[model samples]
Target: MRVLGVDPGLTRCGVGVVEGVAGRPLTMIGVGVVRTPADAELGHRLVAIERGIEEWLDEHRPEYVAVERVFSQHNVRTVMGTAQASAVAMLCAARRGIPVALHTPSEVKAAVTGSGRADKAQVGAMVTRLLRLAEPPRPADAADALALAICHIWRAPAQNRLQQAVAQHASALKGRTR
Candidate 1:
């Protein structure tokens, strides 16, 4: 599966594409940060992010988009911006009918590094190793985005099985009732 992972931020939204299935090495199709002027108006920043995400969608055409779920932070303003940027990413994927998955930072960290509390450097080092890159992607955000993609690629199979089992159970219940 091809996944586009988004690490949303007003100043620097990270985007990356990874393609492969579980138990196999994945390939990085692209990785970069979408920068919007920190001093720009909120609306303009969001628009810029929209355009950048749209471009990624057009180019990579991922089957799924894995975005970091916004969590509460000490700074309300920072959290608000992150939530806004995250919403933009979900909107972009939904508009294209591509499924969007929201993964918490801890969940992604654990999937990639086997530790939920792994630091940025640890996560970066793992991403570099997983992708077999000579070095970690620049700007911690970029590596984080790639890590998100790798996490999704590895986790999706089990998630799909769980979802199917739930659906089958519901269908069996409906048949019994009818």
Candidate 2:
């Protein structure tokens, strides 16, 4: 499966694409940041992010999108902007009929670093090691995005299996009722 992971921000949104089979290592297909001028209006920044994400979807045609969920404190403005950016990403993916999974920052950190509270540098280091890259992914945002993708890929199978088991149990229950 190919997954696009997004770390949303008003000024610079980070994106990464990774491909992997169910039981194989993930391969990095691409990674980059979408930059909007710091001085640009919030509306413009959002538009830029939307357009950039659309372009990415068009180019990569990823099967799924994984975005970092917003969790902020004492900064309503920042939280709102992050939420808006994440919405744009979800919208873009939905437009293409691609399923989107939202992962918390803590989840991504834990997946990559084995610690929910791991620092950025530690996450970056682990991301590099996981991907077997000679160097860390550039721009902290990009690394975060990649981590989000990794987390989703690692978690998806378990989620799918659980859902399947639930469905099977429901079907058996219905049969007995009949």
Candidate 3:
């Protein structure tokens, strides 16, 4: 499956496209950051992000979008910006009828590094190694976006099976009720 992973931020929103399935090496199709001037008005920044994300969606046409979930931080303002940027990513994917998956920072780290407490450097290093890249993606955020995509690709199979089991159980229960 091909997935577009988004690491949302006000100034630098990281975006990457990865393709492959579980138990196989993944391929990095594209990786980049969308920059919006900090001085730009809030609305303008969001617009810039929207345009950037839309262009990504158009180019890659991913089957799923994996976005980093906005988690609480000490700075309310920082968190607010992140939350907004995240919403923009989700909106763009939903508009295209693409399925969206939200992964927490810890979850992503754990999936990539075998430790939820892994630091950025550790996560970056693992991402580099997993993708078999000669170098890690720059600016940390870019590496993070790729990590999110990798995490989703690795976990999707289990998630799908759980959903299928739940659905089948529900259907069986309904038939019994009748």
Candidate 2 lDDT tens digits, 130-152: 88888999899999998998888
- Order the candidates by TM-score, highest first: 3, 1, 2
Which run of 10 residues does model 2 get worst, by summed lDDT?
A: 69-78
Per-prediction TM-score to the true structure, in the order listed: 0.96, 0.93, 0.97
Clashing pairs in 1: none
Candidate 3 matches the true fold with a TM-score of 0.97
In the range 1-178, model 3's lDDT, one tens digit per residue, is: 9999999998999999999999999999999999999999999999999999999999999999999988786467699999999999999999999999999998999999999999999998998998889999998999999999999999999999999999999999999999
- Candidate 1: tens digits of C-alpha lDDT, residues 1-178: 9999999999999999999999998899999999999889999999999999999999999999999999886467799999999999999999999999999999999999999999999999999998889999999999999999999999999999999999999999999999
**Residue 103's C-alpha lDDT in candidate 3?**
95
RMSD in Å for all candidates: 1.1, 1.6, 1.0
- Model 2 pairs in collision: none
Better of 1 and 2 by lDDT: 1
Instruction: Give the count of colliding residue pairs in each prediction.
Output: 0, 0, 0
Clashing pairs in 3: none
lDDT of all predictions: 0.95, 0.90, 0.95
Arranged by lDDT with the best first, the candidates are 3, 1, 2
**Candidate 2: regions farther than 4 A off:** 72-75
Better-scoring candidate (TM-score), 1 or 3: 3
